[model samples]
Target chain A: MSVEHVVSFDRRSFMKVATGVITGVIAATSPLAALVPSRAWAVDLGALTDAQGAALLAMIRTIAPHDALDSAAYALVVAALDKDAAASAAVKSDLLTGITTLGVGFAQSPESARIAQLKAIESSAFFQGVRVKTLLVLYNNPIAFAHFGYEGEAFSKGGYLFRGFNDLKWLPEVPLADSGPMPV
Target chain B: MAQFDLNDDSVAVIIGSGAGGGTMAHELTRRGIKVVLLEAGGRLTPADFSQDPGAAFGQLTWLDPRTQSGTWDAAKTSPNMPAWHCKTLGGTTVHWTAATPRLQRYEMEARSTYGDVPGTSLVDWPIDHSELKRWYVLAEKRMGVTRRHGMPGMPACNNFKVMYAGARKIGYKRVHTNYLAINTKARDGRGGCIQQGFCSQGCKTAAKWSTLYTEIPRAEATGHLDLRTRSFATRIEHDVAGRANAVIYRDSQGNEQRQKARLVCVAGNAIETARLLLLSDSARFPKGLANGSDQVGRNYCHHLTSFIWGVFDQPVYAWRGATLAGVVEDENIHNPTRGFVGGYHLELVALDLPTLPLVGMPYGWGRGFTDLIDNYRNLAGMLINGEDMPQANNRITLSSTGKDANGLPVAHIHCDDHPNDIALRNHARQQGTKMYEAIGARQVVTSPGSVATHQMGTARMSKDPSQGVTNPYGRSHEVPNLFMSDGSVLSTPGAANPTLTIVSLALRQAEHITKEMAAGRV
Candidate 1:
């Protein structure tokens, strides 16, 4: 039998449970959250002040713009940062250290100054690992940014989050037909 | 029911659900045997898969921000390189590049052709390539392996037109796309690949043939396979007789549960397989379960892969097709000229990520970014996937300091390429340089050695119980019904992606087990 058949097996049988429990608990519209304070986990962006969070969010936007292309990755990072206090702490420290080392103080820096500082540090090996890693985290998995229009979540709207198999490329032609920074 | 007293009561405990587990579950269940295929990862629905390279690495391969800081985290914790694996339901097959080239004739007989590498267990396969031919065809058919035929590059895909043209101009040996276990046409309900160019993340559409899409669901449909998602197997349980009995696993909630089975199959990836075996020690088999010979976690090998990139003068969207499309098999066989016993497959690959060009390139970001962009098209590159000779020193050992939440010893790989590995890599580099120059590359750069992503070879197969963990059928000689079906059973890390071979071996093992079960042997 296929997935179609299996999904249909207990489909309607769980609808009441889905609405009664799953929806009442984790659903976005759950009014129950207000009643159950114990259910609400604390979310803190540690080491990063609210101001720092805003500043980094803005900076990431410039570095990786979300014009026609997807910027959900950026929002996911912010969202993740918003939820996990400890994770945001490491990110906050890394970014602050990177920014300060590049001579751009957080509170005093202009938008242009911040961009310039980020760009300068982008070239350095000291910031290379952290910066690249941060981008990878933010862009690839925007779980934190699920609230925002994180495209990744939308991409997984159908349920294929970790679905298909990877096809191995045993043979490939060299000096490829085209090579350029693909459109973002 | 026959009134014969059954010694073994294993309903079915199949490990892994990639090529092997999937195929086995289908066969065994079809033959009326109840199966319990255990995968130590979450199950993914079709909609959960994506075609975005960025998302692929994020969701498919094992890199999540929640646990990205740890040493075992593939996201940030490569020993020294940018390699990783998937921890999701489809296993690493979710992130595999579905290349399915069969083992060459000599790959099965390397020890006979050349003397064994001193510290390495460079032995030939117990079963020859010919033995796997039918299974390879079955795997290819099941996975929807396809060919582009005459459309340029390797016949494997359409994306290699330009690279194929270039390789031909340079007189490099052009290889046809051998076989891929992804759907080119809808087979077993999976649609043909949409070519979203992001097979790595997981196929969002039911276009790609991951086990989650094909075998897992198929097994689930049979009512014979009991899949428990989020159930992480910590160790194997044995009867007082010291034979295989059950598996001890923990739930996502960190609570332990013991599931009994007469027989067990450890189908976790190579590292996890070896780690599980070593951790499942008993007084009777104190070295580890099925490790009486102490070869349970020995002879680990991964292909010695290295990358070479050249700046091209055109705007080829390397990310438009699957990340790879063409291959130069000029040196897939051992030759006296190359002075290496193993062969390497070269393929044109695009970094496929904007940040990949930025971060993957060896140079600094400024120069590196500009250089890569300036000749993105000209930057057609090839990676030499050199096969590593199995070395005992290059094995997976339990870390003295690290343990997972479940208290199982995490896998600590003591992997360092051998001198011959270095020599083989250098030879591939030289060959890549020559190929690049011949292909009219204005400026070609050969990269230093990189960590191989295709991890394999722990708990390898051999004819003798003294020399190998599993016999030729992937069943442990120490335990009558215990089995291994992942890359860990590979005798040698053949010069190809191991996903297909692992599946084929699993299929073969399933056949063997079914026949044995009929005779009441298992």
Candidate 2:
């Protein structure tokens, strides 16, 4: 159970049955994947055509829209999708077809139309596929956590010991009986 | 530390070094008994733990395939991975939140008190609560549990503050940051809780009371405990008279290694323990080892649990402290008026942004789903740990079409909720909502039925040999020299967490075993 062991799971086919868990090894294998011929490895956004990258980014924003994250954070997810698409040509084709069939360009469409289109394509393999892998790349990022008002990284910061761990002001006072010298 | 020779027959061979097995090994070794502890998983040190839940989950979760059946929501939500027990050196204790609640007095005598609840397999423990009280105290002190032995309680994190405010508003009296096996001020050799909030993922600071830092190491220091990790026990070989003589396991090199044993103890969690018993069927005990009553794999219990999240108007930063902070103990007292025989405790559960989506709901989308993640700071969570009734049919059976890496039939867990469990969950839901709404909560969301935190009663204890697999001392009724030192021997699933009870029973079992050994009875 180290990060090394988790990376070892990249070779396990049985472990890839789940949606969210399939996002394994992208961080570890991405650099190596850049070495493979463009025909096999899809590790960079440069490998993805302009329409494919825009459509995937559009899909990711709909999955987890944030007002605060910089364009770089959004670009990180596009890179992740690009990696998956590079590995499977069908994935790229599916993304393109799904975006085309929806008949509303994600970047050009209004918020309501985009939302409605995304909801309609919820059952598609393209949407479900990206939804699982995209979140792993996006939400798990330390940058996204800060933008979303979350303090995700804890163990390395020597934990929240003297931090604002107990600083809550919204709640009312607890009776002394509840906070007794002796445990109940 | 001295390693026991493979041919040595005088040493005790204990399988699966988790809470029960590790504790028993430590106690036995400290008393000058030789013990060879075999663990199926690798050693994941405190240094290996990560702050990220996603990465930590990969490190801690048991990914070995298991097929789940039955009406329980976990069956559908997490079919392949039913219970979230860690397959590591310290077993599930490495991944556990370390919530150690003692069983109430009435919980031990479920059959006598509950009385003929339709469609269930209720039974009383061979031993009572009074018999375990001394051991429980010892376990608490040893683990440095908060609010016990004058150990200061962990500070109330933002999540716990929400729990306290709500519990107080709802007039819940028996509530505080209750018993936790976490360091508050650096007890023993380990440092105090740094408020890492990632105890669920292996504790990197060694602040959690896992055998990895505590018992297993202490046992090794005695030079009487031989700790072998990544050695999977496949069979317990017996002599001509049906007493276990040796254990056949796959070592780290994937080579089969057989170690001679004077006594054998099985603590591979409920599922693996039962499966090992069933797989060890012989001409003498045709059904399985110690399965004369056909009761080895019966009566599996996963506590009826529901995770309730309360979204507030202000930032709560629920994940700022420990994964779990406090408990609401007022509801732990049994009352028949609630239409359930047992009671439940509400414990704090704070999932971060990454896990909230995967576990909070199976598949969520649209603005509502996105909003949940958007307002992650404003949400606080509590989990209901209610006792589930044991049913004879809810069991772990070998799959006909499947086999694992070692060619053993895959374990298929069939869990069906009893009527009492359903009724109790409904009751908890009603009370939980009121408790949250009392403090001006905006909305309450029930997490997807979870992978079981507690699993018990696959190999139950009973005075009668015909009714159970093990005797009062956790010795096998059929196999005199064989034992089960784990939660699998629990007679009934208590509302409280099972680790404390499992450790107490292990201590009691070790005493009985040592005496038996000295008397030449085992």
Best by TM-score: 2
Q: How well does chain B match by TM-score in each candidate?
A: 0.90, 0.98
lDDT, candidate 2, at B188: 92
Calculate DockQ per candidate and list them: 0.06, 0.35
| Model 2 DockQ (Cα-based) | 0.35
Assign candidate 2 its CAPRI class: acceptable
Name the DockQ score for candidate 1. 0.06
lDDT tens per residue, model 2, B185-206: 7669998888878888888888
Q: For this target, which candidate reaches the highest DockQ against the unseen true structure?
A: 2
- Name the runs in model 2 displaced over 4 angstroms: A1-43, A46-49, A65-78, A81-128, A175-184
Residue B420 CA displacement from its true place in model 2, Å? 2.0
lDDT of 1 by residue, B227-337 (tens): 766767788878887778777777667677777776777787787788888888878888888888888778877787666775554434454455554567767887856
Instruction: Please list all clashing residue pairs in model 2, or write none if there are none.
Output: A42-A86
**Candidates' C-alpha lDDT:** 0.61, 0.80
